[model samples]
Every structure is written in structure tokens, then in C-alpha cells.
Target: MDIKLDDLTGSKIAGLINEHLQGMALNSPQESIHALNLEQLRKPEITFWSAWEGNDLLGCGALKELDPYHGEIKSMRTAKEHLRKGVAKKLLQHIVEEAKKRGYQRLSLETGSMDAFEPARKLYASFGFEYCKPFSDYKEDPNSVFMTKELFKK
Candidate 1:
């Protein structure tokens, strides 16, 4: 799969992001849903990427700059038909590399704490993200699990 910078203007990515938000709603409480919509993902602070296999959209992820040295992982989702196919892992690796290239010192993320989000939590943990208190503007929510990893800490 090829990971490419995405501008978030394509209908295919929009539909996938909608699908992700819809799924998040079904799995988490309304207040704990932090997944960004297309407009938010298009913000100047966020860099979005899409993974494709030629003409097929496989997965996507984004890095949102919280500050000059800190970044947040956002909007990670794999196509429903491509679940368990390593598409997400590849996209995530790409995002992490991009974060390091940008000189970020840390990477953080917020995901659901419920059983429905088990796969996501596990995925993050495997990537070295450890549980932490909320970062950025996030508040503690029982439905949310906050995690972070030091990318280039001493």
C-alpha cells in the first residue's frame, strides 16, 4: 500500500471518515466522541494521509500538531472491507514517521476505553503508546482512554 498526503477533498475519503464517525457513535457515548469531521481534519494544524492500493482506498490517519513539539494522532481508520489486513498498521507507521520527521518530541492519542474499541487500544499499545492523563484540551471521560509515547525523548 502507498501512503500519500491527503487534502480531504475527495468524496471517497469523506465517505470513509463518515463511516468512522458513525461507528464511533455506535461504540462510544456522545460526549466521548472526539473523532474529527472532514472540516476539522482539513485544519492547517493537521496533516492527513491516505493509504491506497492503486485505485482502492485502504486506510487513513492524521497527525495534529498540538504544539511545536507535541502532536496528536487523529482519525485512524481502515476500510471495513480491509479490516485485519495490516492496512491500519502501515498507515500508522507512516504517520509516526512523518511526526518524527517534523521534529515532534511526543505523540499522543485518545481512543475509546470500551470493549468495542479493544482493537484500537491494542493497536496503539503495540506502537508504544502508554496510558496517560488527558493531553491537549481533552478532559477525562470514562469512555475515553488517553495515551502517549515519547518519540525522541532523552
Candidate 2:
């Protein structure tokens, strides 16, 4: 798979992001939905990426700079047909590598606490992320789960 920075101006990426947000809205309460829309991801603080295989859009994830030393993962989603095919894992690995490249000391993410999010939590766990309190503007919400990982510059 080829991973590259996404400009978020294309119809395909827009559709994917909207789909992700829609999925989040369905599983989490209105107040608990934290997924960003295209305009939000286009912010200068956020770096978005999408994985592709030829013409197929496999998955996508984004990293938001909380500070020079920290980043928050966002917009993580794999295409429905590509689920369980390592698409999201690869995108996540790529996002982490980008964070490390930026000299970030930590990477964090927020996911749903619902059963629909179990696979995502497990994926982060496999990458050594630990459950953590809400970071940034988030607060304690029973519907949300937070995870973080410390990056070792290699």
C-alpha cells in the first residue's frame, strides 16, 4: 500500500471522512462524537494521510499537533471492504512514524467506548498504547475511551 499526505480536496477523501463521522455519530452520543469533518482536518495543525493500492482507497488517519512534542490521532478509518485487512494498522503505523519524524514525544487518540470500537482499541493496544485520561479539550465521558503511547525516537 502507498501512504501519502491527503489534501482533503478530493471527493473520495471527503466521502470517506464523512462516512467515518457518520459511523461515529451512530455509535456515540451526539455530545461524544469527536470525529472531525473535512474542514476540520484541513487545519494547519492537522496532517492527514490516506493509504492507497493502485486506485483503491484502503484507509486513512490523521495526526494533530497538540504541541511541538505531542500529537493526537484523528480520522482513523478503513474502508468497509478493506476491514480486517491490515489497512488501518498500516495507516496507524505510518501516522506514528510521522509523529516520531516530527520529534513528537507522545501520540494520543480518542475512540468510542462502544462494542463497535473494540477492534480499534485492540489495535492501539497491540502498538503499546495504554489507556489514559482524556487529553486536550476532551473530558471524562463514559462513551469515550482514550489511549496514548510514548514514542521512542530511533
Candidate 3:
């Protein structure tokens, strides 16, 4: 799949993000739901990307700058047609590479603690992410699972 930097105007990417937010809201508690809407993801501090194969949108992910050396993962989702096809893994690896290129010393993320999120947590773990305490503007919430990975310059 081709990973392309997106300006968040594509309706496919926007729809995927909205789906993620809706899923998060359903399974997570109100206080622990940190999923950003399209408006928030369009902020200058966030860089969004969409994976495509010709006219098809395979998946999308984003990196949110938390500080000079830190970044957070956001809006990761694979299209229904692309599920179980490594689309998410490809998008995640691309985002991690971009984060390292940007000189982020570490990458972090917050995912739901529900069963619906198990696949996501597994994907992150395979990339060497480990569970950690809440970071940035986040506070401890049982419904939220935080993970972080240290980046090595490549």
C-alpha cells in the first residue's frame, strides 16, 4: 500500500476517523475517551497520513507532537475491506519511521482497554511498545491503556 501524507480533506479518511471515535465512545468510559474528531486531528501539531492502493483507501494513522522529543499515535484504522491484510501494520510502521525522522525520542499511544481493542494492543506490542502510565494531558482511567516505545535513531 502507498502511504501518503493527507490534509484531512478526503472524506474516506475523515469517515474512518469518525468510525474510530464512535467505536471508542461505545466501549470506553466518558473520561477515558481521548479519540479526536476530524477538526482536532487537523491541528498543526498533528500530521495525518492515509494508505491507499490506487483509488482505494486502505487505512490511516497520525502522529501528534507532544513535545520536541515525544509524539503520540492517533487515528489508526483499517478499512473493512482491508482488515487482516497487514494494512494497519504497514501504516503503523510508516508512522514510527516518520516519528524517528522527526527526531522524536519516544512514541506513545492510548488505546481502549476493551476486548474490541485487543487486536490493536497486540499490533503495538509486536512493535516493542509496552504498557505505561498515562502521559501528557492524560490521567489514569481504567478504560484507557497507555503504551510507549523508545526510538533508536536509524
Query: Please, what are the lDDT tens digits per residue for candidate 2 over residues 38-111?
Result: 98889999999999999899889999999999999999999898999999899998998999999999999999
Against the reference, the lDDT scores of all candidates come to 0.93, 0.93, 0.92
- Give the per-residue lDDT of model 1 (tens digit) for 2-77: 8999999999999999999999999988988999999989899999999999889998999999998999999999
RMSD, every candidate, angstroms? 0.8, 1.5, 1.6
Task: State in Å the error of residue 50, model 3.
Answer: 0.3
**Cα-based lDDT at residue 99, candidate 3:** 93
User: Which candidate comes out best when scored by TM-score?
Assistant: 1
Which scores higher on TM-score, 1 or 3?
Answer: 1
TM-scores, each model vs. reference: 0.98, 0.97, 0.95
Off by over 4 Å in 1: none
Greater TM-score among 1 and 2 belongs to 1
Give the per-residue lDDT of model 3 (tens digit) for 1-154.
8999999898888788878888788888778888889899889999999999999999899999999999999989998789999999999999999999999999999998889999999999999999999999898888889999999653
